[model samples]
Target: MMKVEPASPQYFRSSSYSSCHDLFYEPDCPKKAKGPMLCVKQPSCSESNFDCSSIFHLQEAQDPSPSMSFKQAVVLVVAVEKLKKQVQTPIHFISDEDLYDLFLNIFEPEPIECETVELLDQPEKRYIYRNQTIEYSIRDIDKKCFLLQKPLGSPRLTAVHLQGPDAKKEVKINMAFYMCPGNPTQEAVVLGIAGENLYLCCTGESPPVLTLETVDKNVLGSMSSSELQPFIFFKSNSGSTCRFESATFPSWYISTSLAENERVKVSQLGQTAFTEFNTSRS
Candidate 1:
């Protein structure tokens, strides 16, 4: 027969304890501690009398484990989910409208993946609401993300222009200006392209800067359908994102007016291919 441990206070006794056998022979009792007088059977979960399993006391676990002071599982779950999101390759949208349309076509949730990007603002249908009359305000969250008034809107692309003496200069100009004020004016670089835009990233920067300014509307609106991969893709290499934006763009350059004593010879300024206006800034 099993009785209360000699180590336990003599006055201690639970009303639930029926007999010495009930204490030593209970299911889930530690088998390693067994002696000639003790026997442990599998927990009788199948029994109609069983209330719940008690192999592990969760309340006791909290006291010894990394006891959460916040006491909120939801917060932990949300934090873990956010970390998962940050670690994964970030998903970006070109415009609020296109993203809304993209979201609409998607049915399933959890690490959403879709091959084709759809234009959200459908001009054809007229039903409960019409965008024709609705003028919604929009804001760009740097170049990393865009915040739109509604989930739906027309597809618009972020743009970039690189004009300089050397091919490297073009990239250098793109790197310097595509971030916030505190960051240096140079050294930042573009890592990847998103939608119809370029994503400028740097190892030292907080987030990649997004290029804004559209080269062509049709190109961006139906951009996902493009089958051709051009060798020279400025926007594809440089623009696309709300999660990122430049602190300032490369300053426009002016034509040189060297003094008579100056040795520098005459040379053409930067071409207008980068933007509508010509640039002379190096």
Candidate 2:
């Protein structure tokens, strides 16, 4: 003879609760799914496989899970860890917002692929590279503030998170410096060019503005007039201008750009660099 078991009774029935939660929908049994929905991090690892499995408890996989999978959880943890290490002054980061959305959905028990992988060992440097390179720390707030300096060059975000607290911030990132293309260069030493009129081009900011100072008579007499190229020098390069692609100010900064101070020091035995330039005719 066949027999049917009696149904058990519970105080909270699934049929009574209803709300606007998207998670409340039951994929398997809409009639039986009542009570609070399971969170991605809270899923039982022992009971299920795939997505949330990595972050979920390994021991929990032996039992059924209310929410989350292994793979999904791993992806979330990895992303969160990177953010914490990189915390700094606020800037517009679209990627950070996208990652937040991804975290919420990672636990649907679907397999997830982590964009970052834990390195076996720490790297020697956190390099931000492009046509040129600069070292940066992902964990540093101060460093980020310095990157906003003008003459803007378009930059990119390419950094990889490694494992450990002391672990290096990232592997290699491509750099993008803002470019004004046509701006006066600053802080250049006028190295006078050879010619009848004598054209002077600065080693630093091209077409450097200069202050004219007279070379001492004793020193002037020792060298040929052509080599001395006698002209007065100034401590401050006066008004000046140049194209952005120059010998100095080659990269980008996160902070405000400051005009560096120029100094004038003369030597008895050594020839001083002229900060200012003036023509013999003028």
Per-model C-alpha RMSD: 28.8, 32.0
Write model 2 residue lDDT over 15-68, tens digit each, in one string: 221232232222221323234543332234333331222322212223243344
Model 2 residue 126 CA deviation in Å = 36
- Report the lDDT tens digits of candidate 1 across residue range 75-157: 33443343344336666859989888888798556686779978987433111111111111111221111211112543222
Worst 10 residues of 2 by lDDT: 141-150
TM-scores vs. true structure, each candidate: 0.12, 0.13
Best by TM-score: 2
User: What's the CA error at residue 236 for candidate 1, in Å?
Assistant: 25
Instruction: Count clashes in each candidate, considering only residues at least 3 apart in sequence or on different chains.
Output: 23, 43
Worst 10 residues of 1 by lDDT: 225-234
Off by over 4 Å in 1: 1-134, 138-206, 225-282
